[model samples]
Structure formats: C-alpha cells, structure tokens
Target chain A: MAEAKPIAGTRPLAPKPMSPHLSIYRFQINMILSIMHRVTGITNYFGSLILAIWIASAATSEQAFNTVSSYLATPLGLVILIGFTWSVMHHMLGGIRHFVWDVGWGFSKPAVKFLSWATLFGSLTLTAIIWGYALSHWGIR
Target chain B: MPTTTYRTELKKVRGLGSAIGGPGTDHFWAQRLTAVSNLFVVAFLVYTGLTLAGAPLGEVKAFFGHPFNAIASILVVISTAIHMRLGMQVPVEEYMPHGLKVPFLFLNTFFVIVIAVVGVLSILKLFLGN
Candidate 1:
C-alpha cells in the first residue's frame, strides 16, 4: 500500500447532514397541518370555480338558477358542499397561522404545536357550528 | 482634486429599460394584503351563500340586488381571484420542472382572469337587473 501525505492549511472533509424527507421524520401536527393547507388551497380553487358557475346561473335566468340550486340540494351535492365548506374553513385558519409566522412570531416549539392544533380543531369546530346554524334555520334535512 | 463617490451614471441607467430590476417585494406584499382582505370577504361570501342557498329565484336575485351584497360579492371575487392566482403561481414555479412550469404559469394567469371576469359579470348582471 502506498502512503498518503496530509495536505497543509486545508480542512478535512466533513459530512453534511441532510434534512430528513417525509419518511424519516417523526409524525407531527404541523406536518399534516401544512400539507392540508396546500390541499385545501387547491380544493378552494375548484370550489371558487363552482361558485362562479352558480352565480352565472343565477344571472342567466330564474329557471337556470333553480336548476343549479336543485342539483346542489341533492345528497351528493350536499356532501361536496360540506367538503368545500370544511376546506375553506381549514384553509382560512391555516392562512391566519401563516400570517402570524410572517410577522416573525409563533416559531417556538410550543407555539407551532399550539397553532397547528388550533387550526385543525378550530376549523372543525367552526364548520360544525356554522352547519348547525344552517340546518336549524334553513331546515336542510 | 478628490473624486466624488456618487454613482450618478449607474443611477441614470437603473430601471430604464430591459435591464430594469426591482426588489420584487411587492409580489409578496400584494399576496399578503389580498389574503388579509379575503379573510373578511370570504366570511361575507359564506354568509350570503348560506342565506340564499335553495331559496326562490326571485329571492336570490333580490338578495344579490342589494348594493351591500353586490359590492361585497365583487370584492370577494376580485380579492380571491388575485389570491388564487398568486397562490397557484408559487407551486407551479417551485415544484414543476422548467418546461412544465412555464405552461402552468400561463395557465394560472388565464384561469384567474377567466374566473374574475365570469364572477364579476355575474354579480353585475344581478345588480343591474340586465
């Protein structure tokens, strides 16, 4: 074996630690919260498109408006409507969290966890409350 | 004589033509500003939507005919369209490969414009009874 010489005034190679991707990291609240934020955002785009369609239908004619509304009142349509409602609520709460982080606060470990949980549960709670009010007053059975 | 430290020549050429540049912070600010505005506009939108859902056609038209509801609906559509465009632009720019990114960016802009136009026109038609 040949002998190797050490170089002068040179630093030794150091292994840089790569941040873990999705698989390696332990499951955390913020992970799901962040992913759901993006999911809800994308979903909201389609929901907004539907909303525009509904508005346009209303503007077209009375029969057109009733046609759209009748379909939306069906079971499958209600499911889609509820899903979109939840997405909007979740995305809005998640957006508020992002805004707080943008202002340079809520980066602490506890704060992050708190905000994530709050977003998740707050959205669900608000959605339920709104739907409850909706069902009670609107007689949507 | 001592030379002056001012770069008047550089200042004159800055932001003059194709070589123009900016800090590009306005995009960030605009996104955040629209997001904030959307918070309120979206709430109003939900309230109005829920109230009008499955109602009689004339009732729905009368509801949207109100100036407050009409203005709020317009604001919601405009703010949300801008916010949606900016939001989608980020993912398309960051995650998509180079070739795909360009097409997606163009699509994003077109989609937002279409949504905004349709939404605004719909609301206006109701408000104007035309």
Candidate 2:
C-alpha cells in the first residue's frame, strides 16, 4: 500500500500546549502546605540518616555513644533535633492528608483548606507537646 | 460489506493499557502500601525516641534487647526506607532534568538501602549484646 503524505505548506501550525507557570498564580494556603510536604519529606531523609548514625553510635561503644549524646546535648544539635521532630510530624500529617484524598474524600475546597490548616497546626502542637514532655520528664542529657 | 479500517485487531489494542505492563498499578499500590505501614511503624519509632531520649548506652541496649522493641525498630527502619525512597522519587522525576534524573533515582535507591541496612544492623548489634 502507498503511504499518503500531507500536501506541501498545508500542515496546521497551532502552538503546542504549555504547562502552567508557578509564578503566574497567587499563593494560597494549599500551595504552602504542598511545598512544605515536599520540604519536610526531604528533611526526613537527612533526619533518617542522623537516626541511623545515632543507633550505630550506640552499637559501637559507650564512648561512641557518649560522643553522639554530648553532641545532641549541644544547643545546635537540640535545634536540629527539634526541627527534625517538627518536620517528621508535619510530613506524617501531610501523608495522612494525601491518603485521605487517595481514598476519594476531602476534595471540597473547604475540606482541603481545613485539612491544610489542620496539618500545620496539628504538627506544631504535637511537636510542642512531645518536646515539652521530654524536657520536663527527662531533662536534656 | 467492504472494510474501511487498516489496523489489525491487535494493533488497535496495543498501547491502550498501562505502558509499564501488568495492571500498571505497581507504583501506585506500592506507594500507598508503604505509606500505610509507615504510619504505624513511625508511631512506634517516635515512642522509642521518647522512651530513649536521654537514656544511657546500657539502657538503650537493654531497651532494644527486648524482642518486641527490636522487631519494631527493624520494622520502622525498613518501612521508612521504602516509603522515603518512593516519596522522594516523585520530586526527582518531576523536577530533575533528563540528564540528572536517572542518576538521582538510582542514588535514591542506593541511599535507602544504606539507611535500612545501617539501621537494622545497629539495632541487631545492640539487641544481641554485641
């Protein structure tokens, strides 16, 4: 069979479809929450590495364990640890939000806005309570 | 009646389903499965963290020496590693340029393996009194 070709100079010249640009849209609560979800997820990657190191130090020797413990006692380490706690909480809540959506619920605008705000406040509240209990009960090493 | 179409019955069906084959639901299902498992395991992890917060090395060792704690610790490590790798791949696939995407994805897998191995081994060493 002979293949047919378009006549010369007769093909359509419509522009290709382009993706929506980020800067063109006004920022909203959901946008911040979504970006935060990604940010905290990446943060948890490093946090997991730190956790591995903490466990490895304990397994190595008491000296090794104390070395990590003392470092964690430092203000900077405490800040990082606190930040990691918050990040984990935030990401976990965000994951739950995603799961809720996956199950085909919470697509309504009000539900979405409520969930986003709830995730933010909920994470902060959990982080505070955890740290508060830890500090009051354990007293930093 | 004369036929007007040239495509074979097979050709018409080809490329109609998931490009990755099977039900094409592997990634979707795996991601959600890990996500669900992670919710439980990670709660255990946080509890472990809280209990061990300022614990000495001996205490820490004793804690994991318990069978349940040791098993839960391993579960947390494995589940988190799988979930993180799957989650991270989304950003790498979406934002990374073609030149860097493949390498990033490979590195993501490699990194997750390292995390899981190191975490589980450490817990085992402590649990075993090594």
Candidate 3:
C-alpha cells in the first residue's frame, strides 16, 4: 500500500444532530386552532363568492334579482347565510391574529397559547354578537 | 458578532419578511384589488336589494336588463371569482399533504373556474334581453 500524505487544507465535519420529528408529539391545542383558522378562511372565501353571485344577479334585472333575493330570504338559505356570516367574522379575527404574527408579536409559548384562545373566543363571541344583531335587525324574516 | 440589528432582540421572530420576498407581492396586490371590487359589489347589492323593496317580478326582470345593472354585475362576478381562487389557495397549501396537494390544488382551481364561468354566463343570459 502506498503511503498517503495528509492534506494541510482539511476541515472537520460535525455530525449533525437529528431533531425530533413532529409526528413524535401528540396532537396539540395550537395545531387544532391553526387548522380551524384555515377551515374558516376557506368557508369565508366561498361565502364571498356567493355574495358576488348574488350581487351580479341582482344587478342584472328586477326579476333576476328577486329570484336570487327570495331564494336567499328562505329559512334554509338564512341558516346557510348565518353559518357563512359566522365563518366570515371568525375568519376575519383569525386573519388579524396572523397579521399580528406577521408583524413579529405573539410568538412566545404562553403568548401563542393566549393568542390561540383569543382567536377562538374572540371569533365565537364576535360571531354570536353579529348573529344576535342580525336576528334583531331582520327578525322573523 | 454582537447584535447590532434591533431585529435580533426579539426572542421569537415571525417569518413575515419572507412574504415580501416570495409570493407576498402577488398576494398583497391581489387582495387589495379584490377588496375594492368586493366593496363595489356590496354597495350595489345593498342598493339593488333596497330597489327591490315592494317591487313586482316584472319590474325586477326589467331592472336586470338595465345597462348599469348588467355592467356592474359582470364586473363584480369577474373580480369575485378571481378573489375566491386566491383566497382558498393558501389554505389548501397549508393543510393538504404533499401527496394530495397537487391534485387538490388543481381541483380547487377547477372548481372556482367552473363556478365563475357558469355564474357570469347565467347572469348575462338573464340580463341581456334574449
């Protein structure tokens, strides 16, 4: 065997530590809250789409508009509208949380948990308040 | 190196800066556009709803065929459909697994496109005085 010379220019390689995998941990409150945020966001998106269609239909003519409005004014339709309204407010609050996060606040462990609860309780509370107002404004409709 | 930058002081840094570097521009601009479009839509819708106050079916139909009504309706539909696609896309990216991501994304886009086309055409057919 031929003798090999050691190179002067050599660097040591540190064995990289393997971080624990995400799956190793059980499901968490923050994870569920994040998922809900996305779910509400999607719902609100579709709700807005429906709103667009309603407006377009209304803009077209009185008959077309009435067809859309009367359909929307029904009991089942109102239920869907209420669900959509709640989703909108919920998603809006969640969005503000995200925006706050974007600006670099509410990321400490305790703060994160606090924000999670805030997002949840705040969304639900706003949703309830809006629905309560809605019912009063258009009660028995 | 000592922390000369003020950003280093925060114990937990939010990854918001990346938004500006990558898809941030597209998302921000699109959101602004959609918001403006939707405001007009809301306004028109509320107005039309009020106009329908005690109005008969015949009057309603004629109102749709009205020029301002048709133009505004079409514009709102176009902006809304585009907005819907953009809004839902982020959620799909966030939640769906890698294996199912591509397919679901396609489906999402396809679904929105179909709804938008169908919706706009429906409104047009109703208002264009066939």
Local distance difference test, candidate 2? 0.87
The per-residue C-alpha lDDT of model 2 at residue B18 equals 46
lDDT of 3 by residue, B1-130 (tens): 4323323222124545546656777887786577566657745754564465345556655777888886776776677677778877777777788788889889888888877776667667658754
Best by TM-score: 2
Comparing 1 and 2 on TM-score, the stronger one: 2
Query: How many collisions between residues are there in candidate 3?
Result: 8
lDDT of 2 by residue, A52-79 (tens): 9899999999999999988997889889
TM-score of each: 0.83, 0.86, 0.56
TM-score of B-chain for each predicted structure, in order: 0.80, 0.84, 0.73
Q: Which 10-residue window in model 3 chain B sums to the lowest lDDT? A: B3-12
Q: In model 3, where do residues sit more than 4 Å from their true spots? A: A1-23, A61-63, B1-83, B91-130
Report the TM-score of candidate 2, chain A only: 0.86
Clashing pairs in 2: none
Question: So what's the TM-score on candidate 1?
Answer: 0.83
Best by DockQ: 2
lDDT of 1 by residue, A1-141 (tens): 122332465332234345678989899999999999988998998788789888999999888888888888789888888889899999999999999999999999999999999999999998888777776756863
